[model samples]
Target: MSHTSTMISEDIEAYLKEHEQKDLLRFITCGSVDDGKSTLIGRLLHDSKMIYEDQLAAITQASKTSGTTGDAVDLALLVDGLQSEREQGITIDVAYRFFSTDKRKFIIADTPGHEQYTRNMATGASTASLAVLLIDARYGVQTQTRRHSFIADLLGIQHLVVAINKMDLVDYSQERYDEIVAEYQVIADKLGARDIRFVPLSALKGDNVVNRSEAMDWYEGPAMLELLETVEITHDQNRRDLRLPVQYVNRPNLDFRGYCGTLAAGVMSPGQRVRALPSGKVSTVARLVTWDGDLEVAYPGQAITVTLEDEIDISRGDWLVAEDDEVPLANGFEADIVWMHETALEPDKLYDLKLATRDVAGKVKAIDYQVDVNTLEQRHADHLDLNAIARCQLELTAPVPVDDYRTSPGTGSFIIIDRLTNITVGAGMIHRPLDSELPYEFREHDSKANVVWNRASVTQAMREHLKGHSGKCVWFTGLSGSGKSSLANALEVELNRRGYHTMLLDGDNIRHGLCKDLGMGEADRAENIRRVGEVARLFAEAGIIVITAFISPFRADRDAARELFNDGDFIEVHVDTPLDICEQRDPKGLYHKAREGKIRDFTGINSPYEVPKAAEVTVNTEFMNQQEVINLLLKAL
Candidate 1:
């Protein structure tokens, strides 16, 4: 085997030994475009002589394809490997690279710089102990520069390095470097960055990146490499609270069973008592074992299988926490979110939330505010679009174990998933549970004396016969201005005239009252339909046929609402109007307004409108009038 391959194998053995000794540190590099982040890391690895001969040959060969410059090898290409990313000459995803010096080994997460990739940067900085924010000397501190710094601070990265790169462009001038340093100092103060270090260097020219720059005689600071080698990162971790979220329950053999997961925070030893959260079951640690052998104790950064003294019904998604430390439990929480999906976040829609290893169904209950990343100020917004950072309130179907992100990074973060597409839409940091202070109390109330208020015990058959028809909900759905409201209104009138007690629920009318507080985002729209469906069910229970007119676009959301109703009770009537016909009609002048961009998030304009796959009745508004569409809906009913 080659020397480098042999060294890598030896390093793996040493890594296992060091892990058993419980010593590891993780850091992330975050900055904007042309910040020299990739080069700085490349310099660190190169100066340490960690690059293999084959890798060096590849980089040299790749460098020949482009024009020869002072530092021709595009070091950024070493980490960014995607075809599109290479073509655009930009980093798009979080690329992780591992390297080590004599002093300390490091796992570095190199994040992208584009504003659109802010979510990727968050994923990199989520579990990092320190963050390196690179700044170009010419631009000083741009909006993305400030935004990235703020995000690092929000993620609890206490240690920060503001590497002033591209000093060659600025003539290695201390005055220019000092001016940029002053600009970033204001941001550091606002963000509460405790340990801030400013270093001036040119990554391309190999000055002060790996070794001290001879050109920068006026600058008096340790080189970037020297600082990283000696920097103390151990104190940055949360060692006070012992939190180990159980990822999987290992029951491989019938004779043995244990909890298997990485130690997220703090330390635990054999014979130490640990409590299982939610259940409050306490057990003593019997043994901590890895693949190699048993360990007397295990700390954070060590992945081990833990065995308890007694058998317990412990499973995945449960937290194994220190007995003395407080554990978070709440059904409702408020969080700051960085939306990453094209679909806007809607208040009132249920989303699948994934936190750590636990998954829970949650709904966006309220939108507190959105943060303008440039100004770092909260602004009022009805809905959050892609790349928007907003503070929102969420109500989980069941209580989840969580923590304040400022206190514990691991348990305090979550991701929002789209129920239909199963796509991760946003990343969230839990600020606090809605009811953090109130102590949890469970009590049973006494039953009141039995009483029957209603005089008549109404049967379903008798109620249907009295109404002269069966009670059901006629769900009219189509694109906006597709005659859904007109058809539903006409149908309600006809049903009432036919002696069937009928109620018309227009989407716009319900938005004025029942869903008045909600917005028009994807999540909010789904919630609006959900609430309307429930109200229609109540009307149906009262033996009244309910006609609901809504632009219930997404099939998944419509299906979810339909699932709540009994079979044959919910009838979907699709108004199949072409986009061109709806735009031509423009009955409410909505299409004209959409064309003029008077309002944002108008369906079929700025947002997507999903067509229903199956419907009980499909009425083409082009081929028929409102009366004819109503008749078709009535026939299905």
Candidate 2:
């Protein structure tokens, strides 16, 4: 070969090598207390020539003063950045280290092994693709080792490198390595961690970590660094479904309008069809805007601004998704949580749930069960103490779009914050949303607690006998612009003239004061009905005829309202007004606002109105006159 050609070949080889090393891996080191997690990381950094000369000198000097590693350098000092950690000779928090080799770049988290800091380890492991579980060859597998392994399994870590460290303590015997591996295999089988690789090395002596171990020649496997560099993680993410949550609306000028957020999943290209969640508005992607100028395409994890071809109602927390999938849209969810607080989680106490970019109020409805890390047993737990992992049902005050955690964790996981204190209490993984069964239990008990039959002169039956009629809660439910409020007020006027004490609770009038803060979103609207349902129940107990007008969207919420009343006392009055008639009438001009996109979650427009399954009286305002509807309600009463 020519001399000039040889130089050019070398340059191409260097570029290829650099490109190969750009693949990044994120892994975590976790085990029992004093398992040398920090030491193993320190040895990797030191052997890879990553440690500076001055930094090495400081660690070498600290080793002489506080020789945790005996005559050698205290490598743990390299990762133990906290003063408390150095003083206690233990890792108390999750410490992250960034390093690179000729083959790959790596980000390793050194997690604490102490039981008290187990939650911290989970936080670090939550985002890791692989786990380096350390097992002491001398002690075999300990309890904290099982704890770490169980947590890694729960967090969905698919790859595990079981490093049998401190092999020098056992004279580097292959027999001891085999025995420890056999013990861990049983636990690994239980965790269903099939992709487990075993390696025996001494982090203190720097054996089989970055270099082949001369002490154990019988066993041959790639060193820890090689496995980390070669492990396939590019395909681990959910790349099929597109989820771009709008974090901010980027408007640099009148000419430019873009939605800014990191793509949580899948890919997006210009002109691709996309749908906005909750609003369900479909539009074509106009541009993939970035700081580097407009791009033709964008993939998951890339932060970019997206522009749509048509203008629509979109705000922060709304998701832009591929227009070809059915995802759950709701305000409540059943979730698995890891409690990280000192105080126990209460069932009914309201909490601030922060799911991705959205913040809303919710409450833990119930603790189904807690898992035992040692045995992997599901034990009954009334309340979750610190570091307790359990499945709990949560009820949010508004509807949210949450994908299943197994499918899309980025949009499924959330943090529970104390409403008043604003401190994060726990981390939650959404299993699914509670569209019906759950949350009913929450409202059922809440309304029941406020009422109790007591001895009194003015008894319910006595008041009914004197008034010559039983109290009734006539629930007027239908779509907005369906003349529900007008019909309810007219019926109330007729009931009063018939010598029956009556009152009407209009939906709009109630929103002005009682439900003013509630949004028109599905969840908020359900909550509005719940609040009004309770007040209507109070009026019914006074032997006075009570009537309510609301678009109460869900059958489950309406059922919960009825659960608070006695049988036959609560009357469901369905206003059977067709959508076309209501839209034409548009008494309050709501349908016009809905068509203009000025009103969101307007029933029969954007949000749905689940018609009553069984109503005591059904009246059609378009086909019948006002007196005919009033006569039907009176006959039913």
Give the best candidate by lDDT.
2
Q: Model 1, range 1-637, lDDT digits (tens) per residue?
A: 1113343566888755654454345778878876777777776667668777887778677666631233567676667667676666677898887776545667888898898888889889887878888999988898888889888887788889889999999899999999999998888888866788999998887898777899998988998877876778777667788888888888889988989887878888898889997688999889998997999878776788889998877888888888777787888888988888889999888899998778889988777768887778876676889878888888898887778888777778899999999999999999989757543343443338543333332445546655556778889889888888887878878877777898999989999999999998888988898888888877887778888889888888789778767899889888889999999988899989888988777888888878778788888988897776766666777
Clashing pairs in 1: 346-524
Q: Which stretches of candidate 1 lie over 4 Å from their true place?
A: 1-25, 66-71, 253-255, 437-637
**Residue-level lDDT tens digits of model 2 in 1-637:** 1012343466888765565548788899999878889999999998887888898899998888665978878999999978788888889888998887766778899999988887899899988989999999999999988899988987878899999999999999999999999999889887845489999999988899988889999888888877787888878778899999899998889887899998988889998999998789999999998877988888788899999999888999899999986777886788889999999898889998888787889988777678886667876666888988998878888888878876777888899999778899999889987773332222233443565434442457646655678888999988877778889989888888888998789888999999999998777878998899889988887888899998887888899899879999999988889999989988789899999999988878888888888988888888999988988888888
Model 1 whole-model lDDT (C-alpha atoms): 0.81
Query: What's the TM for model 2?
Result: 0.66
Best by TM-score: 2
Clash-forming residue pairs, model 2: 330-400, 331-399
Where is model 2 more than 4 Å wrong at Cα?
1-21, 192-194, 436-637
Clashes of 2: 2
User: Which consecutive 10 residues in model 2 have the weakest lDDT in total?
Assistant: 436-445
